[model samples]
Target: MADFTTVVSDAHFLEAPRWHEGRIWFSDFYGLGVSSANEDGSDLRVEAEVPGQPSGLGWLPDGRLLVVSMTDRRVLRREPDGTLVTHGDLSKHAAGPINDMSVDARGRAYVGNFGFDLMGGAPIEPTSLHRVDPDGTVTEVADGLWFPNGSAITPDGVLLVGETFGNRISAFDLTDDGRLTNHRVWASFGPLPTDRSVEVVLPALAVAPDGACLDAEGGFWIADATGSRLLRVVEGGTITDEIETGTPVYACALGGADGRTLYACAAPDFHAEPRKAATEARLLATRVAVPAA
Candidate 1:
């Protein structure tokens, strides 16, 4: 447990860490790229350069990679030779910038967005969720959502999405033909506040951050972007535990040999301009008991 260390730091913006092919693969948001590294933070490698800002990341059944190109509202596939090609164009389907995503065993990816101009300093809009099929078809899964950030699919293929602006997690049914149905609320906040408030006023926690993953025990690991903590939630939407970090926790995933190590990609100044920020962005790793199944 004590061996955990910082893998990468001073990064511009980082997201989406996944354990694939014996390594940790993720996307660099403000860095405008994708990369991989060993569990021990060695053998670091840059896998691709996505020009439009890559967000959520997933793997196809055939060893290819899928990334959400946030700026342009598109999904891309990384070929074996590290070339990125379009998997689907979501310009008309997405109401806002797509954030994090999760791919099921069948290669269907569920994506969500900001729902409005968040950084523009305007009011928040209703963000929605979309489901992308393997055939490159995009469909609206749910609408009128608060800001959908990180998302995950259960081993049974049930979809769970983090509603950042709503401060709750939503569960959906994934049909056999790749349709999302039976939308329901899975979890929400209670009476306690961790550490996300600012200026003596608690910021409304509607799941405003990004990146999420499922644990082997059927629980979900969520990054409290403003809270500076990682929360473990069960299927019934109970908070099992919460672990604190130095910076605002933006994204998270399970890596390492036993899949028991949780890697959190955090940044001290996430929305701050590069030169004006105090702490540089970083990737932090910690150990956990349960593995991801």
Candidate 2:
């Protein structure tokens, strides 16, 4: 286990961490906003407020902030003047609440959804991944995903997505127009789960990948929601390193002045009711060998 330090304490379930513009930016589900802080957790600033609950955080090519409003299934864009406006609406396409997202340099956002009423104890179901263009057009680029969650785009144009219930990291090639092609599994922890019930599937999963980020050495640092740890996995499902979080780590990002800091969003559990009523969630950090990609 690495020596972990608290970056931000008393958060209401932090998720979707990103290193951008010399700061660590993230979303707080029950906090109803997005925030950024300095590398050592100083100079904390609330960037945007989304009453629907913010999950994902990204930036457009023009530097406008893009946020995922989970409950309403909409993407909100923060203009230069700091006002939020609907950038894209996924209400019609998404079956459940939309969650994490990854934005490419071209401002194309690849967003994912829960696919089922996770908090309501509904059975897990496959869902689609939507691509939001620069003009805010929502298109279902891929489907049959078991709880698509965190995502990242490599420098070589490969889109890697973590399927929380699928026990695998799926890859896709992005076309010039931002469309996904050549879908394949980048890493598989185990065979595709056969059970749909959360009770049955979660205990059987080899790795429950939740939030992830890419590193310069082609490694993927993933927060294993079920394992209460963060794993450094390479191609073909090989876990090269692991960090025992001692708490449920839902998301992670690699960032710092030198890009060697590994930041994790952690809490006791991911239950909505409990998380919304308390402030036990925290952003923890540790030093790592590799830098961000």
Candidate 3:
């Protein structure tokens, strides 16, 4: 087991962690904002406040910040002067609140969303993934995903998306025009569950793939949302390493001065009511062998 330390506490459910510009940037869902902190838990700052709730964080090539506004299904871009403006509207494509996102080198963002009322206890349904161009055009790139959540784009253009309820991570080949093709299973924990109820699916899941970050060796460090651990997974469903988080981890990111530090977003549970009612979530950090890709 690796020793974990709290980097940021009293957060209202943190998610979508990313290592950028020597800081750990993440989203606080119930806090309704995006924040960043120094790796050693110093210099905490609130970068942006999203009334609709922010879940994902990424940057454009030119250094502007892009955030996923969950409730309104919009991607808001933070101007250089610190103003937030709607970059893209995904309301027509996303079936539920938009979740995590991955911005490619060309500034194309692949966004995911919940397929149903997850916190309201509705049956789980497959959702679609959309691509938002830098010019703010929204297009559905793929559909039929089981609760599409966190995503990461490889240096070579392969996009990996975590299917939290499907027990698998799906991959797609990114075309020059920002469309996703060659859809296949990147990693599978078990057969897809036949039932859709969260209660039935939770206990049957071997690994609930959530937020993930790629390593230099092509390994993916995934937050096993249902298992309360961080798994270093290579292609073909093999787990090369694992870290016990003690709390349910929703996201993980690789970063530090040397890129060996792994950060995790954790909380007691993902229930909206409880998370919104109190601040029990934390950003935990631990050293890892592999660095960020």
Q: Which candidate is the best by lDDT?
A: 2
lDDT of 3 by residue, 1-293 (tens): 68999999998999999999999999999999999989887999999999999988899999999999999999999998999999999988899999999999889999999989888889989989999999999999999899898788888889999899999999999999988999999999998879989999988999999999999999999999999999998889899998988889999999989999999999999989999999999999999988999
Where's the lowest-lDDT run of ten residues in candidate 3?
A: 147-156
Tell me the TM-score of model 2: 0.99
lDDT of 2 by residue, 3-107 (tens): 999999999899999999899999999999899999989999999999999999899989999999999999999999999999999999998999999999989
Please give the lDDT score at residue 141 for candidate 3. 97
Candidate 2 colliding pairs: none
TM-scores of the candidates are 0.91, 0.99, 0.99
Clashes of each: 8, 0, 0
Overall local distance difference test of candidate 2: 0.94
User: Candidate 1's residue-wise lDDT over 79-149, tens digit each?
Assistant: 78878988988889887888788888889888898776655655566667888888899988788676788
CA RMSD of each candidate after superposition: 3.5, 0.7, 0.7
Candidate 3 lDDT (Cα, 0 to 1): 0.93
Q: What stretches of model 3 exceed 4 Å from their correct place?
A: none
